[model samples]
Target: MISEEEQKKEGKNEKLLADLCECCIMLHVGFQVSPKKVTSVGVHHLLKVVLKKEESEETQEEVERAFLALKNIAMWVKIDKELHLSEIKEIIKYHQKHRNLTHLAYQYAWEFLIHRFYSNESLEIIIVNELHFGKEAARKLEELRKNVDWTRKEDERGKETKEVLVITGWMKTIKSYFDSCKLWNEEYVELIGSVVQIYRTAKDNYEEIRYWCVFSLRNAAGNGFVPVDDLLKSGAVGCVLEDIRKPTLIDEITHHSLTFFENISRRLKEKTYNEMEEAKRKELKRKVLEKIEEEGYEEIIISLHERLNTLKRKYFYGDELSLNISDYSVNI
Candidate 1:
């Protein structure tokens, strides 16, 4: 298998260049590269070529054939599942660049599949693209968010409508929109503060409200409206506060997400500010090393080692240190 480093070395057009030919050998290799790694730009380029061909008797047949091949790649190989959320945003940017939304429906389909496979109650971090500036993306996301089903108890009186808590990528899209608006961040923070109050009040009485708090924490993490570290820590606190509710089977099941959130939350807190700062410094040094090579700089290999050793001594070992989690032991 070609390493990601090797693929990166070949430049970004790896799959697109490979897919242009009809030969089975090249096509087979392209398919083997995995849909997850198959850049969306590559897919869209192929789609454009097929769809825009000058009309001939065989044009429709050829386009259909190409579409089928790409479709098979998307479905059979689970490209969406392989793609990172950031990569999807990059794909969307590629489409926007070409003024093509022809495969947008496919993009949404992939996003949904990615969410379905990756999202669960326990996962704390959800990296989502902030689509505040794109009207089309906002509209599409609004349609998805509208499916939130909220209901109320018949016996409950003088209460506001309760909606099913939605855990989704769209909330981030909406929050990003608000953050981009003038005075919205101030309002957004106030709104979250109020919600935090509600969570505190309802902690004793309402299981549903507790659920909303958990959901909001995840949304806040995805939107980057709040530090992921803070939201996660709050989630751990929720496990302690909500433990008194004696949650039902369903609530118990849902609490798994809260627990996962708690785990990630604690992990982040364990990461000292000093450690992160030192790591960043080391990273900058590494980048400088790479830049030196890129510029074809001539330097003594021994001098390079000495310089690296000095930098490493200052930043490499401190109260601030890097982390590598090879395994996890969860005590439930």
Candidate 2:
């Protein structure tokens, strides 16, 4: 009862799968023996194949294969980011929108792209920001938040079920953008609200989500890149205040919160911000200093000097340099 078109489509899929399998085997064996040298042209063709198959309504298995092939190729060849603007936007557009297609995307973003060799000061950042990649990530994270129960219980989170790890991995990748490129793109700023919303709503036992959310926000707050209005609008400052106020907060979370406050005030600290070219920018920096005082955050920062001294004296009693808390500055 199969139609002729359906048969042809099945044949095409089978051939594509066979090709992907062969590609994986070849790469796997080649890598074990020695590193392979793939040219940029070869890498580009492979990327095209991966994109073509992934963008189609292929089966999940096919999508996984495509990304696996991407991983293998990336191990050998640094992707030539000299891609044309139109091509860069198209690639990021698909990758961001189809982030939920497979877990391989998570590893590729973290393990290969961001963690390893991706460059800064590239057109890639501009295109990704313009495409609203961060907004797409926020949307995917919101969707994952609903199925989080599947990941909470130890038994339910078995070998094959690692949805939450994928979510965190992608969040880490985005955080790298803040630390590395430090762009002031508005869409990236908007992502902060979604992370805070998830952190507030998830159950107390769901610490992975909260931990990553705080860490990511901490980087953005401290990086001195994003505009103050955009950051304030994203609700990040309020959410961080809540975290600081929590009675049972862990030291790591508290440490990051302090860093976040420090970084936000950096605008006023170093003559560090070139945005000072305008009078409004200077006022915004002053507002940051005022907000820190309103919440008694300056006091909290002062306490960290003592806390650091105690930690160093306990763990590193013999090292005089480690004991120096005199240089610590609240910079208000």
Which candidate comes out best when scored by lDDT?
A: 2
For candidate 2, lDDT tens digit of each residue in 1-332?
11222246434454443454436434565433222333332344444544553444564455455555555555555555553235434555666655544654534433344433354356446535565556666766777767666435555433433667766766676666566555556567667787787778752656666777787887776565666556667878777777876767676666666566656655544554455465565666666556555777655555566565544444321222222332322343
User: Taking the tens digit of each residue's C-alpha lDDT, what string does model 1 give over 141-227?
Assistant: 344335432333455533533222222333332333323222222334444444444455455444655555545543453333354
What would the C-alpha RMSD of candidate 1 be, to one decimal place? Answer: 19.6
- Model 1 error, position 207 (Å): 15
Q: In angstroms, give how far residue 175 of model 2 lies from its true place.
A: 0.8
TM per prediction: 0.29, 0.66
lDDT of each: 0.38, 0.56
Residue 200 CA error for candidate 2 (Å)? 2.4
TM-score of decoy 1:
0.29
Error of 1 at 39 (Å): 10
Best by TM-score: 2
The segments of candidate 1 whose C-alpha lies over 4 angstroms from its true place after superposition are 1-46, 49-140, 147-226, 229-246, 251-255, 268-332
- Residue runs of model 2 more than 4 Å from their true location after superposition: 1-49, 52-58, 68-77, 83-117, 150-162, 272-282, 302-304, 310-332
